[model samples]
Target: MMKMMRVAVFVFLFLGVAAGAARAGWDPKDDEKAQQAVDYIKKNAPALDRFFVHAYGFAVFPDIYKGGLFLLGGAHGQGYVYELNTLVGESTVTQVNVGPQLGGQSFSEIIFFKSKADLDNFKKGNFELTAQATAILIKSGMATNTDYSNGVAVFALPKAGLMADLTVGGQKFSYRSR
Candidate 1:
């Protein structure tokens, strides 16, 4: 059936993109990449400094690859999770969406947990970000007074590429002990 074929092709393309991203410079142990991400965020979103210093925990995904074609799209990235300034674990993110969309992009994302309970829930290996979850785009002079909706605040910085997508998607995160 045409529907089955379309689904098959979508899966193939999604997996290819995910595999390519995994093979790219996405190593969880890349300290330099992690540091660069941190520095970029601090410099561009100074207001987040307060959040960074005060957050019970946070996760930073240095580089995420996203791509889409027609009605299918996905993204993947690896990152480090920290608690009280100490490395706590490694995390991976995967997102899938369906809608009218096309193109590809790369970006960095950070999520801050406002409380110990929130961080604990995220570290439980079943954390997910629904379509309702929103991420602020990092820009110069951006205000940091953003409240933690649902105990979490997210920020994203575009790195490279371009994408035009209007889709419904959510991100799922899996964590592992460091």
Candidate 2:
């Protein structure tokens, strides 16, 4: 029984590691998802341009639903970034282990880039999400305030439906411009 337990433990550990590696691995759709997110930036380009240009930082969060058929909504999963149709960015994927809104919800977020230097940093393909980065869950809006002094821009908008900003995972991340 002892030997059997040891074997099971080893197998579990191996599989767990392998799973994490697979998810972290560069995903093909990641590029497409990143481009899709660019739409938000284009919509708010005037305001976004003032924030960053040539190369800058941006971040995005999409709707994550987790509830009944009619009440579907929740913010769960990771978001990626793209520039000039390239997969050159990643978000600090957050997993809400436990919370009051444990069911399902829908939300989305976007970060913009304005300078070549900052955008280059994002396309570097090795940078990770920073603790100071801010991410706000948006419900609806044409544009929001992106304090450039902080070297980051976080915007939130709703595709549809209503939600609270708190439950929206008010997180902050960076992204580059097109």
Candidate 3:
């Protein structure tokens, strides 16, 4: 029981620190930086144009910080969600995992909602990525052949960092109107 309590405290503290870090770097109202991020993704993976043109909505997180120590891990990031080229809201992603894991890394992630239902589910305030969901690493031709799985498609671009972690976690999100 004492060990479990210590683990709980560690997880809470880790998540609090990660949340603060995420908030420090994210400004939901910063449209200029958001656009730059979008541009970067588009420039690096032109194949994603099809998703931008066809997806009912999408969310882009300019940067995500993930780190783990021993049996605890956490990640956090803020993003903008758009529907049909119009900004609909701002969203935050948070993830926590428990397993044999360690190290830290940063990456950019984007999720494309293939239909209104999927977007609606995301905007409903409590949405999560199941363990089965996986993101494709962005590359020159990767997106060209990528297809949506279960009404959504995800792409990730590593910014910088190195980490060796074996963890199991699901990403959860909260949304707010812009």
Task: Enumerate residue pairs that collide in model 3.
Answer: none
Q: Sorted on lDDT, highest at the top, how do the candidates line up?
A: 3, 1, 2
How many angstroms is residue 169 displaced in model 3 relative to the true structure, after the best TM-score fit?
0.8
Candidate 1, 1-178: lDDT as tens digits? 5796498476856685655453333346566666676787788678788889889999999888988878778888888888887776778888888787789999889999999899999999768887788578887787756878888999888889989998999898887765
Off by over 4 Å in 3: 1-29, 140-143
RMSD of 2: 8.7
lDDT of 1 at 72: 77
Residue lDDT tens for model 3, 1-178: 5696488667767666756553444355577767877888888788899999999999999899988777777788888888887877778888877787768899999999999899999899656886678678886656367899888999988888887877788898888776
Could you tell me the lDDT of residue 10 within candidate 3? 72
Residues 26-94 of candidate 2 have per-residue lDDT tens digits of 667767766666665456444555543533555555543322221112233456664543555565433
TM-score for each model: 0.85, 0.48, 0.85
The parts of candidate 2 lying over 4 Å away from their true place are 1-21, 44-46, 52-55, 64-74, 82-86, 95-104, 113-145, 161-178
